[model samples]
Target: MTDELRTTMERVGERFNLGEYEIDAYLAVLEHGELTASEIAAETDIPQPRVYDTVRSLSDRGLVELRESRPMKIVAVDPGDAFGDIRSSLAEMVDELEARYTAPARDTEAVSLVKSRSTILRYLEEIVADAEYELALSLTPDLLRRFRDSLEERVAAGVSVELLVTPASRAPSPEEFDYESVATEARARRGITTPVIAVADGEYSIYATQDALRDDRDRYGVIFNRSALGFLVSGFYGTVLWTTAETLATDGESRPFPRTYASIRRAVKDVHELSGEFHVEVRGRDVATGNEIHLEGPVLAHEFDASEQVASFSVAGEDGDPVSVGGLVAALEDVEAQEIVLDRS
Candidate 1:
């Protein structure tokens, strides 16, 4: 808060001062190019008594021109001319404020609440760009476009991305969009009820409503950055939202082997679809003792519940004994796998 910066900020605030009534009255006059005080009250909800004062305030700020004739007409000044001086001042003020801004502690906070649409969007982009292996996202068509480049970067880095775009009809067709470059698989859901979500490596995630992406003041988004806690988001996405979505695109190219995963469900699904013998190396915690364990051997068997709520796989250990591995916060299985690597040689 240097003196120069604080002075500039106060000057900008004073020059652009606008209240609810002033805004409504200004818009009414702008829409019609000019309006009498009575006409402004008719066009907007601004009370008849307040229209004169509101317009007078606008005139004081050089946003509107007032005629002294009968009825006192208010004319809209060209916005470009009206805001010319303050526009530069506002930009300077923003630069000064941003210099003083502190970034949110994403790595330290287990969970955080955010309200701005821009902040939510920024976190979504960071999540997609930061994924090292697995990614899951539910986005609108507009958001899909906004983060397309980041998704493509992750896909090229061999990250597995499962994308869900809502309002099926509005999603781009395969001909119009290159799905192969952005996702391992993509699905479309039929309605706007889907919340905007992004999970990175099954750990970092954000959950927000569609309303949170709009100009509305009442909406919010939540971020979850703790390890293992991400399964809450991924589980909900897989069991509830992903199951109901219609597949739109899937990468047809053969994926290179030696794949890695932080999710047991995805690992089980991939391993089950393979034909020949495949080996798995798992790093997880023993369900019984909660002690960390590392196991590696050929896959023996796997199970998936119809509802996708439960998924696990068995692998032979060094002692040639079968050990069952499950996902985060596992209950029934022998091991709660934090990471699984699948390789076929």
Candidate 2:
């Protein structure tokens, strides 16, 4: 903090920070080019007694010039000249402030609630940009469009993105939108009941109602980062909102194995569409023992519930018996998979 810099900042602060009367008087004189104290009081709401003090304050700030003629005129100084020093000082001050700034640690919290719309939007963008492999999102049409460019970039970088836009009626038709550029697959759900969600690489996620993204007083979004609890959000998206969505577009582009998944339902869906024997490596926890388990073998069978919300696969275990694997909090299966990797047998 040099003395000169400190003085310049103080001068700038004094110059632009104005009271109501001073602002009114300054603008009145600027608008009329020049005006007497009587004219200024008549043109603005500043009372006659306070008009002299207001104009004098403006003059001291170098915003206006005072003429020593009869009636004492107040003249507006060209704003370009008046504000040049202030602008320069502001730029310098901002540089100094930025130098001292420490970014808030985003990964320190496991779960957080955010209320501001801008903050929610920022988190949405951050999650989208941060995804390295798989990304799943449930968004409104406007939010889809807002982040389409970033999504497209991720797709181009070989990141698989599955997008769900709701309510289905408001989503763009295949003819009007190029879904392939932004998503590996894109779908539309029939109602606004689908919450706005973004999951990045299965670990970081955000969830909020459609109302939370809108301009309303009561709104909130939840953020999950580096937490085991994040799987709950991804599971809900895959089994709940995603299964009910009607496919709007799919590239049908086959990605080479080994592919990884955070959602078992998605992994099962892809395996169901395959032709022959495929191998899988499951990183998960035993349902009964609550202990970590890793299983790798040729996939024997895959199952889906009537609604297709629940999905699991059977693989030969250590004793040559089939083990059933489900996603997230898997109570009905032998193991709850946190990540599933697939490849050729």
Among these predicted structures, which one has the highest TM-score?
A: 1
TM-score, one value per model: 0.82, 0.78
RMSD of 1: 3.5
Off by over 4 Å in 2: 1-86
- For model 1, the local distance difference test gives 0.87
Error of 1 at 77 (Å): 6.1
268: Cα error in model 1, Å: 1.9
| Every candidate's CA RMSD | 3.5, 4.4
Task: List where candidate 1 sits over 4 angstroms from the true fold.
Answer: 19-56, 64-82, 215-218, 304-310
Compose the digit string of candidate 1's lDDT tens values, residues 1-345. Answer: 889888887877876678999989888888999999999888999988888888989999899999999978899999999988788878887987898899866788788889998899989989998999889999999999999998889988999999999878899998899888899989999987789899888889999999889767558999998876777888889889988889889872367888889888888887666677788999989998999899988889899765566689899877788888888888888899998998884
TM accuracy, model 2: 0.78
Error of 2 at 306 (Å): 6.3
- In candidate 1, residue 88 scores what lDDT? 85
